[model samples]
Target: MKLLVVGATGTLGRQIVRRALDEGHEVQCLVRSFQRGAFLREWGAQLLRGNLCAPQTLPPALEGVEAVIDAATARPTDAIDQVDWDGKVNLIKAAKAAGVNRYVFISILGAEKYPDVPLMNIKHCTEKFLAESGLDYTILKPCGFLQGLIGQYAIPILEKQGIWVMNGAAPIAYMNTQDIARFAIAALDNPDTVKRSFPLAGSRAWDSNEIIRLCERLTGQDARVSRMPLGLLRTVKKILTYFQWGWNVADRLAFTEVVVGSEAIIAPMDEVYETFHIDSGEITTVEEYLGEYFSRIMKKLRELDYDREKASKKKLPF
Candidate 1:
């Protein structure tokens, strides 16, 4: 089967690409930057240059592809609509025109109830569209990506003083990106997972403190877990909002709601395990994930430091 993976360079998308390739499927990745996807070319994936925001780039990417998997990331509010909702519509249309059959999407868990929340709302809308489109579809609503805990959050803490700062004591159901990719590839390959929204997650749940404790066990460091006050965090958020910079106030507000409204959003790991018939033991525990992640980041930092030291020695009063 010829499968086209959108956002193939992203965290979840990359894993999906690898898993699809491992399953012996011919893969094509729709990437915005040729330079960024150059590495994938060596991995035997046909790299097609395209942007999701640009509909003109869709037809060529969809041409001759039998299946589609979307792991695209989007901002909470309008951006989510723009990407997940609007961009998906474009892709569906193009896929229909190209005579493609299967479509698999990566969504967040609890999207069904939190249609008021920007992120979940957009996913819900997109999911609705996909279901109504008469296309063979499988939707995987995953929990907080374990990869984000490593790539997005933990790397910053490791660079700093081993401080993991979070908003509250909210519990999150997290899952490995590898598992997500595997599920997505399974949906693409098997006919059974179609027209269903599988809630994907790990074997357990953890709050910020518990996560920190596990991190400590992994790195053998008493990592300090700091909680930011809501009022103060909101004030800083509003200030950043005024500047309209990375993660603006609206984004912060939405995230604050997501974190504080955890009771409504959080799902049980057993739910996902039941749907996929996957053993909970097969999933990576928080400790296992942290150990592997920390080692990789340490290697990266060492290489970076070595390069800096060498460059510093070569500087001759330029």
Candidate 2:
């Protein structure tokens, strides 16, 4: 299969590209800048220079590609309409024009139910557009990405003090990007996944306290946690947005209110496992993931400390 992956530099996109290549597919990645895709080129993926917001840059990227996996998003609230909504619609049109067979889209888990939220509304609208675009489509509504949360929230806090939880007791399932990529690869070729919109989640759900305990067990260090009321968190996010901060305040608040405020974001895994013939045990556990991650961090810190000590010794006078 000849595959075109949009947003190939992103966390999930890189995983999907690597997985697709490992599966022996000819992969092409659409990137805004050639320099950004240097790693992709080294990994044997053909690179197409294009911007999703520019329709003229899309046709060449789509030509001769059998399928497309869209994982693109515009950061902050300002660019959602142009990049997330319009850009995707343009890509769908280009894919249709190029006679592309399958279009796979990555969307949020609860986007359909909360269309009023700005980011969710845009994604929901794009999902509708893809469904009606006269093309075979697979829309994957995945829960919170486990690696993403760890990188953004867990690692930084664990390195300093403790993890912060907006609602400590809320049930949330964190799915690994690797598993999502596997399912996406299956969707690209499997007829059973065609025209199907399904919720993807990890095998288990954990609250914030459980996550902290897992972190403690993995790092063998005291993992402190700070909890905040959900309503208070929302208020702070709103104020941050009002101040025009660079962070994606609107999207963050929506995620907090919708995903974090709700019970576990999950679906029956047996059917998907059976259909794709994937093993449930293959799904990564939070402990295994955090253990390896913090180990690397600790190793790097040790190296830095050793370098500093060597430098001090060099500066010492006998």
Candidate 3:
């Protein structure tokens, strides 16, 4: 069966495309740009160019597609009205119009339960719609992405301040992007996964302090992570991002709950991981994950430094 992957160029989407290809499924990748789709094309995916806002643009993209995987995202405000709510709405409508079945949607854990979080709330609304859409659908609500932590904040913090920073020592379940991709591929291949929503995470939870300690041990640097006060952290984030984004807002609230309010009992990491098969007593440990993650980050940093050196040399007025 042919599968269509939206947002094929994104961090998690790329992994999903790779896993689907490895499983011998024919893949059609929908990307916003042709250039960005080259990698997917290289991996034997039929790359289609289209924007998510227009339903007509997607039908042709979904032509001859049996299943559609929506791995796309946008800003919360934009996503709630567009991707999560309306984009999914359009995808279902288009999938039906194009006669496609088995729609696999990637979401986040705590969506239904954490409706106070704007993005999760949008996803909750979208999930409600998806359940009512009358389509063979599988919704994957993965826990916090491990890759995002490493790339979005850790490496930069390590390089600049030689540490990872956070508001409080709260243990949260996290999952590798690769594992999430593998699970999605399995769900897509197995008919049993249809009409189900699975929450995924690592086998264990690690707090910010523990994670930084692991990184310190791996990198051979006694990098120390200084805890930022919740109020101060929020102020810094607001200033740095110019109040445009708030992925950190949830963390602040969680920290406040633990500090000023009740000690929130986060679900057992094993339970969440079990749903994704990572907690079934077979998965990488935190040490192993951190080792691999740090090695990759170091390699990327080296490459970036080398590229900068070469660029600087070329620009020299000799």
Best lDDT among the predictions, by candidate number: 2
Q: Candidate 3 — which residues are off by over 4 angstroms?
A: 75-80, 152-154, 157-164, 224-226, 232-282, 295-318
Q: Is candidate 1 or candidate 2 better by lDDT?
A: 2
Q: What is candidate 1's lDDT per residue for 139-188, written digit by digit as tens? A: 98887778767643475456545453556646777878898887788777
Model 2: residue 207 alpha-carbon error in angstroms: 1.5
Q: How accurate is candidate 3 locally (lDDT)?
A: 0.71
* Local accuracy of candidate 2 as per-residue lDDT tens digits, 92-166: 999999999999999988787786677888888998999899999999888778887575456755676656677
Global lDDT of each model?
0.76, 0.83, 0.71
lDDT per residue, candidate 3, 8-113, as tens digits?
8888899999989998999998877889789788889888888788777888888889888888887424534566567777887888778787888887666676
Q: Rank the candidates by TM-score, best first.
A: 2, 1, 3
Q: Which residue pairs clash in candidate 3?
A: 82-87
Give, for candidate 1, the lowest lDDT window spanning 10 residues: 243-252
Query: How high is the lDDT of residue 64 in model 3?
Result: 88
- Candidate 1: segments with Cα more than 4 A from true spot: 75-78, 151-153, 160-164, 233-249, 264-277, 295-318
The whole-model C-alpha lDDT of candidate 2 against the native structure comes to 0.83
What are the candidates' C-alpha RMSDs? 4.8, 2.9, 5.9
- Taking all chains together, each candidate's TM-score versus the true structure is 0.83, 0.88, 0.78
